[model samples]
Target: MVTLRIATFNLENFDEVPPNVRPSLAERVAVMRPQIERLQADVLCLQEVHGQERPGQPRALLALAELLAGTKQAAANVVTTSGPNGEVFDQRNLVLVTSLPVMARAQLLNTLVAAPMYQILTANPPAPQPMPILLERPILHVELDLQGVPLHVIVVHLKSKLPTNIPGQKVDDFTWRSADAVAEGAFISSMKRMSQAVEVRRLVDSILDQDPAGRIVVAGDFNATSDEVPLVAIRGDVEETGNGALAGRVLVPVENTIPEPARYSLFHHGKGQMLDHILVTRNMLAHYRGSEIHNEVLHDESGAFATDVKYPESDHAPVVATFEFA
Candidate 1:
């Protein structure tokens, strides 16, 4: 049997910004290189990667691959999809593999999904206005050959839960920001994430429709916790029949092996939260050996952010899952 390690990490906007403006590429690499080396993942899915806006310009992803040179976990093969152009900030999802051979690669972006009624009509308009549904980040899909075993991988970064309030719009008058403004904003954000999750599930279903026993892995910074609506939608609730047969194919979150208090990936205002996850289909779960959340790498000896003489590595932690193949 062959064991493969797959990991997902959010690089926290790895871009080549002007020096002193933000942490430069060199600074990020300085802190991230060692952490990635420790992961030693055969297949790595990355989010918040800054892609080059120009069509033909040099890509930071390639440069990151170069930085892994001479490391045990060097990504000799890498794949990435471009984001929308002419934006002040451009971010993308990327996949890097050291051994697995990619069989196919595709990306989902700007795809439309059904919008909730509340989003379409503030208070029942003459006609429901069309609301654009765009993915916060393109889902990076890659099919890899792990010693002849086809493994389907989908990398995603769901919409963040930030308040969506427009300027000059009174809190009481805004549809998304009324008496319960905070709750309303959260509902809107969750709706966006739920739409994205639905799309991911559709992609999973597409693969399953072709092969019921397909091995699939979906990993990334979901930005939502395990019990949240978004995750609930992606990892459908389990249902069983009298004969003990699963109702349908449902993804399962890899068990959190890390000790209780330390399982979190990010800390905000002293509250630690597990925003990153690695989930696998039932077929893949049969081969799942174990999983790990590399939260330790995000901190230093002093238990604070890993300061590399300049800046912190990343605000998020990396999650790794190991699976055995016969």
Candidate 2:
């Protein structure tokens, strides 16, 4: 039997800024590198990693490369989601790093599910036509060979609960002009989030249809808790689906294995929440050894105090899970 450790972390807008920036690359690396090293993961899924670009050069993960420098993962195989132009996005790119051999890799954004068209009820002028609720980021899918063991991993960074900006909706960036605008903007955001969730669920089902016992893991910052709609949609719980035959396809949250008090990965308004997750198929549960959330030093990032302070470390903690596959 061989043991594998998987970890997911949201670096929280990890990128290079000007020299005068509050949190320099060195400062972030000092805090983040140790957190990553602690995981000792064979496979790592990262979200919110921004790409840096220079004139006459393609966008690259320079900040990420610097953070992984001299580390085990620095030399590992890396795969990242790119745009239609076949280039990595300038911001919030999903990245997967692994020491194991990568067998296949792909990305999905509105591929399995078509984006729904909706007319903004709060459009500045009279609305003309509906617009597609496009995804801001794509899901990174990779198939790895753990020696002879096949492992399927999907990394995603779903849309945040922050309301999508609608024309004439906001007085400023954070301030809304009225409650109606806030509600409508939030509704549109929810639609996009739910659509992405359905697409992920469809991809999970497609894999299971081909191989029921597929060893699969979906990991990242879902931007929602386990009891939320996105999690519910992807988990496909037997109780919710009312089908025992589909139980094998159900994905279980690894964070659930941790104690209630220690299960959270992020703190908001002083309350702990599990936004980051490592979900595994039920068949992999037998090999599941344990799980951990390195949140002992996590801080709340909800109020003015959080905004005033430049926390070197990411607000979200790194979550790791272990499995022994024979």
Candidate 3:
């Protein structure tokens, strides 16, 4: 019986910014030490990582590892994957582990992201931007050998659709119009998000259509609610399609992770929303029978995240699960 633990976190602004007006690298590392250590996860997934340079997220993984240096087995390595924040020269994906012998020999399983599905977000604007054009958001896939059997894992972050109504924004008043601008492509920025989510589903379907027996875990900030459209569409469970299979839910049945009063990754209309998520294919879901979102983050004892006490953890918590290799 081989047990593999999987977890995903939106490490709130976890980056090595300027390094001037910030906590020492050492302090930052210490803050995360408890979380990573508590997880004792064999494989970890992270998003919202920032760095100064090529797919280099803010060395948060390194910092956290450093904080847990002596304890982490001597066989761990960092695998960096590029994300959408390349232009911001910030936030990237970092995969860390205590041990995975197959890692040294495991090849990228299914990363044939179509070229046409290019990213739509650009950190740098032609007239007023300084970042790169959106590429597809990074999703890390690796097939690990657990007790001689191979298991696949995928980590991802989907497009966000929060801060819904911005003034001066060319959003159509859906109630007033036959269809809102978002549905009709009113704001290129907002529409791009919907496009990204669709692309993810397309890619996932393409992958599973080829390997229905494959195990896949799709997790990250979706920015859409369990009752939202894009997600409903992914599962084809929306009233319109009446046919999707994907299921999304907060690990704990009670105690909402998306708290009120500016909870979630960002604030919109003075309300909090959950953009972070974890999704599993029907096959994989069966194996990963149970999971939870560790919303208890310690980003700060005060400030935008002061309300957290009973649950002190990342603003965007870590969603994790343990599974039996079937």
Candidate 4:
């Protein structure tokens, strides 16, 4: 059995820039390097990495990987792409850094459609500003050979509280028969994205459909709570989400790999919110022995090893899970 530590984190504002703050990439990398090294994840998925807006800025992700590899003695093999949208604020989707070599690589696997009513409406008291076009977030997939055996991995960062409604008025808020119409419309849009979530489910099932015993793992920074929406969506029932599915039925939450809320990857305004997760199949969990969402590396005050130097590294903590692979 081979134990592998895997993790995912928002790495909040990897390129956060204050209006007056000069773009200081090295300082940011300097703060995060140690925490990243301490996790020592065999597979690490990241969010919010920024790059050249006008082809002149430095590459933050690779440079950090270089710094980590150089300073902390980490040799992370890394792969990443810019955001799917042409104007994604120079922010990228996912940077999958791993020591384990990947078998297959794919990106932007799916997208959700908006409620039709939203498309037909015009902004009430129309804003002097241009409207926002609704966009579905991207999902990244990579396959790796874990100890000579194959494993499929999918990484996703879904949409935030972004409503699918047009500006000034909810589709129903401004139109005729708007009450139930608006509520139902918004719910339907939610269901659409949720359906997109199920698409990944079916995609996984399709893979296991051909190879019933195939080993697969889905890891990401899903914005929803495990029980609230995302995890339960794929887990088959509207109830609890699980670690595996086999023979066409969604399996129970075996191995209980993902921990409770206290084990979260992000904090906001002093409150802890766990938005990162790792869901594995029974085939993989059979070898799974350890799992924990690590925050010790944050280097924040009130935490074990607090330091202002490390405090500015990132707002989100890293969630890690360990399992033996064979």
Candidate 5:
């Protein structure tokens, strides 16, 4: 049996900014290099990666490839598909692989449903209200041949839960804006995230339709809790009806393999949260061995950010999963 280890990490806008910034390129690479080395994954799914402007331009991903040049996990190929537009803000998804060859690759952006600018409200005073909007992010899909086993990997950075106010409307525009209005904004964000999750589920269905026992792995920064609607939608939890005719075959969250207290991948406002996740299809789960969340690399001995860590590596940690295949 051959064992393959895979990991998902958000580099936090790597190689796109100028060196004059708080955390210079050198500073980020210094910490990121060791972290990647420690991960030692056969294939790595990276989010928030900076893409190349033109076909033949110098890419930030190449710089990252250089960082891993002499490492044991040196990638033979670094793959990143073009986003909807040519490299906007250098935000994109990237895949780095060592020995396994990427048989095929694609970017998924148009499959997700887009939310309209406004929705109709039925109330005492009906108004054309604004709903949470969905802005598509490029999802990196790559098919890799792991020891002759076809493995489909999808890398995603779903819509965040940040409150987005309507156009020409600020959060504090009016001192007395109703609490309902504020709550509406929050609901919109959640809706956007849920839409992305549904799209991912659709993608999974498409793959399974062709091959019932397809090997698939979905990994990324979900930006929502495991029990949240967004995650639940991706997991495809269908309540069992006595008939057992329409049961959904959903992906399993690999975090469950680890201990509860140590599963968190990020700390915000002093609260530890598991924002990063690695979920695999039922077919792939049969070979699943174990998983880990590498948070120690982001902090020092005293659980503080590493020295000269202006950026602190990333707000989130890397999650890795291992599987055995023949």
Candidate 6:
């Protein structure tokens, strides 16, 4: 049997911004590179990776390249989600790097489900008609040849818990003028996040419908905990479906196997949260060995007092899982 390691990390706002403006690329690399090295992953799924633009050239992931400069993944096959123009966005691009042979790849954006339309209840004038709720990012699906086995890997970076903006409700970035507006904004954000989760669940169903025994693995920064709505939507537990026959279609979170004390991948206001995840189909879970959350150096990014803090490393910790294939 051969073992394959897969890892997911959210390099929080990873970019080549000016050093004086934010942490320089080299500074981030100095700290992040070691984390990448520790993962030793055969397949790496990355979120919040910014694309860089150069004169007369399409956008490039310069920052990511620098981070993997001397690592084994430096020469791996890299794939990223792109916009309608076939170019990666300037910020928060989903990336997948793997040494295995790639069979096929696709991106999902309102492909399975149509975009929902809703009227803004908190707009200033409240006179406009309903508008389409567009997804901020696409779900990346890649088919890889892991040795001789066909493996389906879906990478996602779902919407954050931050409230969606209302036309005239915000007093500032972090403050809202009206509590009602804040509630509406948060409702809109939850709608968007749950919609994205529905789309992902539909994609998973499509794969399972075509190949029931598909070796599937979904990994990324879900921005939600295991018990949250987004996860519950994607997991499709048999209990929720009330159909035992659908048990084979369920997806299990690998982090559940890890000790609760060491299960978290991020710290917010002194509370540990498992926002990053690696979920696999039961067929693949049979071969699962163990998992790890490299969060020893994690520091709280949110607190009561506001203070400018610059961390060279990413706020999120990397999560990895290993599986052996016959």
lDDT of 6 at 150: 86
Candidate 3 lDDT over 141-258, as tens digits, reads 5556566644455555654443233223332553322234233223433444555555556656665666666555555666676556656555443344443443321122111333
TM-score of 6: 0.97
Better of 4 and 6 by lDDT: 6
lDDT of 5 by residue, 27-85 (tens): 67777888888887887877776654446764346556655767766736667756445
**Candidate scoring better on lDDT of 4 and 5:** 5
lDDT of each: 0.71, 0.90, 0.50, 0.61, 0.71, 0.90
Query: How far is each candidate from the true structure, as Cα RMSD in Å?
Result: 4.9, 1.2, 8.3, 6.6, 4.6, 1.4
Cα-based TM-score, every candidate: 0.81, 0.97, 0.63, 0.72, 0.82, 0.97
Q: Looking at model 1, which ten-residue stretch has the lowest summed lDDT?
A: 119-128
lDDT of 3: 0.50
lDDT of 1 by residue, 185-235 (tens): 556677777788888888887888898888888899899888777787787
| Candidate 4 lDDT tens digits, 216-271 | 77776666666757567765652343433333335323325454545656655456
3 or 4, greater by lDDT: 4
Off by over 4 Å in 6: 304-309
Q: Please give the ranking of all candidate structures by TM-score, highest first, separated by commas.
A: 2, 6, 5, 1, 4, 3
**Candidate No. with top TM-score:** 2
Best of the two (1, 6) by TM-score: 6
Off by over 4 Å in 3: 17-20, 52-68, 71-74, 83-90, 94-98, 101-136, 146-150, 162-186, 237-272, 297-313
Pairs that collide, model 2: none
Over 4 Å off, model 4? 16-23, 53-63, 71-74, 82-89, 109-122, 125-134, 162-165, 168-196, 237-261, 268-271, 296-311
